[model samples]
Each structure stands twice: as structure tokens, then as C-alpha cells.
Target: MSERRRQFDRDGFLVLPGFASPEACAGLVAAAERIVAETDVDALETIFDAKGQGHGRDRWFLDSGPEVRAFLEDTPEGPKRVNKLGHALHDRVPEFRAFSDDPRLDALVRELGVAAPRLLQSMLIFKYPRVGGEVPAHQDASYLYTEPVSVIGLWFALEEATLENGCLEALPGSHRLGLRSRYRRDGDRAFTERLDPRPWPRAGWRPLPVPAGTLVVLHGLLAHRSAANRSPDPRRAYALHVIDAETEYAADNWLQRPADMPLRGFSTPA
Candidate 1:
């Protein structure tokens, strides 16, 4: 069996404890906090309120907020404020890039059997105390499209993720069964079409129990969702999507990438 098969079988999810360190998490937290703090130099636009926490009369229900957008504040012109801290924190850092394309990261993907990996997208997710974000039951591929159904998602914990803080909960091994067709006005085509909703057999359903600093690599088809931050503390996770390198992007815009992108030979970016 492959390393991924073993890990997924044993723990339902693979937790590379300490994949990220406390110190590293601290810096990121501070940087993100600065962005939340409204300031003159850093005026943000929309905060993309995932929970609709501070929505006003004008706020609308978006399927999903911008992958990267400005952080909002309490003022009337709040939503217009760019996510100053978020943008600055990630944009100015070399580590984020390094981590995203890290050879070790690629190796983990290889270990998972994703022959060649393609860097798709990356984003930082933060769930604050009692912020309980609502995530409908569905596998990621139900929302994202990638070839071969072998896209590996690397979620790096930036804080001590606990049940209270609402860590990412996933049903592992579900990828083997293939994608589930789901429907959402704002859902990804990968799962937009309605198929069998039942995650049958109960043999492949594995819910993850991950800790802070750990890297959990999961197949995109694996069913997963972020739990609500029910505790007084906050939970932060940075996720990056890497697909089998033979993967292709055949679209003009991001919302839609062509299902068929040309494939390349076996090679590592490292």
C-alpha cells in the first residue's frame, strides 16, 4: 500500500504534527490581526464575512467570498476597506511561496501518489471564537474541478486546532468513490450536478482529527468541511491546492478553468 493509503487507513486523516511551528503561527496571527484593526494607512473594502457576522442592510449573501479580498470593518464604508493586513501579510512574505511550492510539500504529494503536482490556488482561513462558519456537507471536488480527481490539498495549521476552535473535519478515503454531484447557485461545477448524495457503504468515511502545526494532505474528492469555531479561541489554517502535474488549466478566467489542460511528463518543481 502507498504511504497515503496507510495514513488514511490508520487515522482517517494524516496529521504531520508540527508541520508548522508555534512561532511561525504567532507571526501570522499578529500580521492578520493588524489587518482587522482598522487604520488610516490600511483601509480595507470587504471582509468577505463568511458568517455574515457584521453584515448590514446592503450586505448580500455570496456563494463564497472572494478567495482574496479586503477585510471589512464596522464603519459604513467598511466593506470597501481592503484586507490590508491579510494582503500585506501574505504578499510580502517569501515563506508563503516557499511553503506553497516547497519540495518537501511536493514530496508529500508524491508520497500520496499524486505523480506530478500542479499549484492551483492557496488561501488563509481564519475562524474566530464563536464565529461558527456554515459549511454544507460536501467534498471539496464538489466545489473545485481538477483532473484525475487526484488533487492534493495541503492544510497547514497556524494555531492549535481543537474541536472547540473548529478544526477542519473530513471524511477520508471518500475520494476513492469519486466525486459527488451537488448543487449550489454558487457551487463549483465539479459537484454542481446532482448525483448520489449518500456517501454509501460507510467503509471510506473518515473524519479527521488534526492538531496545530500539522500538515494534512487530502484528496480533493474526499468529503470535508470546516467546523464552527465554538470556543473562545480562534482557529487558523492555510490551505494550498496542488494537482497531478499532468493536470492542465485550459480556461481564460479563474472562476472556470478548462477541464482538459495539456499534461506534461513526470518531473518535480524542486
Candidate 2:
């Protein structure tokens, strides 16, 4: 087994500093900035608060499985700020597509035992300067669930992620804690159903402040969270969630796509 796989198995997450080039990170940041600049905030009313009630069940949030869509948020600074551009940024944006299709990702997943990995979801998360909200500690499997829990997250830092700018903090070996809840859709409504009542640890989370172009690989069931950005600079990141193609994706999982929009693997051309 590769060293990275061994480390991930032990820690539930891996930080690969400088995994991406400086130029690549800059390109992604520029693309996301352009999208935000062009967006009409006044028309976008639904907010994307991860800690909100029902986890945002509106049509604008629920129906963004196949296309690129933007979600706004009301921060300490103000309302209507772009919270994230998600679901299919990699599939729709040329600049994002190029970065998402990097061959190194293919080899990395294979080494980690993710055979026939499929790209399940993508998002550019924005931690707006002095306004980004706190992301509650949670497991990724609760959202993008699979039969055997095959989901994994590749979070790339497009800018410096520091303590002041809300870098990621993770509980080592927390994947073994098992899934705590499921974010499900029933009819048109969405809700989180508790599967385990065990409380997350109050301490022991290790902060992962990293430089630009760093990649943080997270296990599906890992417990991770980030604080509100209080610095002058914004913290930008591109997150890709992948799952083993062989696993059975739960039908009730909140994010769903039409049959025509089949999931693509790293080996498949964009």
C-alpha cells in the first residue's frame, strides 16, 4: 500500500501541500471571482447556510444537481453575498473542468482503493472576508451517501487558508465514529435524520492551515469543520466529492440528478 493511503487510513484525512501549482490555483480563483462579479445578487434570495433549518430545501438549492448554480448568504457584513458556486462547476466551467480532470487525481484515488471512482459533486466554497459563517462539524457521508460509504472529498485551497481566514479543522480518526445523520429529501422537503446519537468530541480537532494550491483529502465519514473568516482576505476553495462507481447511491440522498446527466469518472473525458 502507498504511504498516502496508509496515512489516510490512520488519520481520516491527508494534507498534500503544493499538490497543485500556483498558476492553477490563481486561475480557479479568477474564474470564481468573475462568476461572482457577473451574478445579480438582488435576484438571488435563497441563502446557502449549512447550519440553517432543513439545510436549504428550496428549489434553487435542491435542484442544482446537474447545472452550475450560485447560492447567496447573509453574513455579519451583509446579505446577498455569494456563498458558493456548486454541483457542476467542474462540468460547466472550462477553467474548473481542466483542474478537475487532472490525471494525478486518478492515480491518487486508485491508490486509496477507490476503484472506478465517479465524480459525484463539485463546489467552489467562498469564505468571504470578515463575513464567512461557521460550518458545523459533520461527516460528508451524511450528505452524499452510498451503500458502502464510498464518498471522498478533495478540497483544494485556492488562496492561503489560515486561522484568521477559517482553515479546516479535523478530528483525527473520526471516520470510525460512524455516520451521525442523513440529509434526506422526502417529497419536496429536505431534513436531517439522526442515525447516531453520539455527540462529537468537544476537543482534539487539529487545525490545518495551508498555503495556496494545497489539497486536503478527506475520508467520507471524517468529522471536519471551519470557523468564520475574520481576516481581511477571503478564503477560497474548490471541493470535489467522488464516490466509488460500484457503490449503491441512496435514492433519498438530497442531491439528485436526472438520468441524462450521468456521473463521470476521472478517466472519462469532461
Candidate 3:
């Protein structure tokens, strides 16, 4: 086995520094800023409550699986603070598609044991200073579940992620703990269904602070969370979730694309 695969198997995650060029990171940051500037908050009704009971599920949030949409932060400071732009930024946005479809990603996924990697979801997260909400401990498999649990996440830091700006915190070898819950869609409503009663272990947890061009590879079941941003600098990141196409995607998964719009691989044209 390759050293990268061995490390991922043992740790459930990998930190690859300089995976993206500084210019690439800066361009993505500028693109995200432009998207936020152009977003019309007056028409938006979904306040993204990351820590709420519903977990930010709504018509706008649930139906954004196949398209690009903006979600606001759950803060009294009003609706201008966009928590993230998500679900299909990689397939719809030119800048994001270019960044996500790099040849390096294809090779990386292959080395990680994914025979055919399909892009499941993508998000441009904007943890605005002071108002960025906390993301609780959770696993990616809970959301984008597959029968055998074959999903990987590539999280790119568009800006330097620091402890002060709410960088990712995770349990080192948590993927072996099995799935804790599954986010299911029941018609128009969506909710999380518990699969395990045991809570995430607090021991061996660590904060992962990385530079702007760093890429954090996460196993699908890795328990991870981020605190609310308290610093003046914003924590901006781009995340892409990919799954092995050979696995069976749960039919009732909350985020589902239209039949016509199938998931694409890294080398596929947008």
C-alpha cells in the first residue's frame, strides 16, 4: 500500500500542505467574496442553524442539491452574513469547477482506493468573523451515506484557518467507530436518524490549523467539528465530498440530485 493510503487508514484523515497554489487560493477567495456581495439577502428565508434541531433543513436548503444556493448564518446580526454557498458550486460555477476538477484530485482519489470517484457535493464556506456559527461533531457519512460508506472529503482552506478563526477539530482515529446517525429525507421534511447511542469520544481530539493552500482529506466517518469564529479574520474554505460510484447511495439521502444531473468525476467536463 502507498504511504498516503496507510496514513489515511491509520489516522482517518490526511493533511496535505501546498496542495493548491497561493494564486489558486486567492482566486477562490475572491470568487467567494463576489458571490457574497451579489447575494440578495432580502429574498432569502432560510437562516442556517448549524446547531439547531432541524440542522438547517428547509425547501431552499434541501432542494439545493443540484444547483448553487446561498444560506445565511443564524445570527441576530441579520441576514447579510452568508454561512455558505453549497451543493453544486463545483458543477455550476466556473471558478469552482476549474479548481475541483484538477488532475491531481483524480490521482489522489485513485491512490486512496476509490475505483471511480463521483463528486457528491461541494461548498464554499464563509465563516464570517464574530458571527460564524459552530458546526457540531458529525460525520460526512451521516449526510451523504452509501451502503458500504465510501465517501471522502477534500477541504481546501481559501484563507488561513486558525484556532482564533474556527479551524477544524477532529478525533484522530474516529472513522473506525462506525456511523452515529444518518440524515434522511422524508418527503418534504428532513431529519437525522440515530444509528448509535454512543457519543463522540473527546479524548485524542485535536485542532487542525492549516495554511491557505492546504488540503485536508477526511474519511467519511471521521467525527469533526469547528467552533464559532471569534476573531476579526474570516475563515473561508472550499469543501468537496466525493464517493466511490460503485457504492449504493441511499435513496432517502437529504441531498439528492435530479435524475438528469448525474454526479461527475474529477476529470469529467462541467
State the TM-score for model 1: 0.68
What tens digits encode model 2's per-residue C-alpha lDDT throughout 167-214? 999999999889999999887878889999888999899999999999
All candidates: TM-score = 0.68, 0.97, 0.97
Tens digits of per-residue lDDT, candidate 1, 53-81, equal: 23222122121122233344223532233
TM-score of 3: 0.97
Determine the backbone clash count of candidate 3.
Answer: 0
lDDT of each: 0.53, 0.89, 0.89
Cα lDDT tens digits for candidate 3, 1-270 = 999999999899999999999999989888888887787877776877776645435888889988888888887766467888988988988999999999999899889888899999999989999888899999999989998999999999988999999999989899998999998899887888899999887688899999989999999999999999999999999999999999999999988899999998886865
Q: Single out the weakest 10-residue window by summed lDDT for candidate 1.
A: 56-65
**Each prediction's number of clashing residue pairs:** 16, 0, 0
List pairs with backbone clashes in candidate 2: none
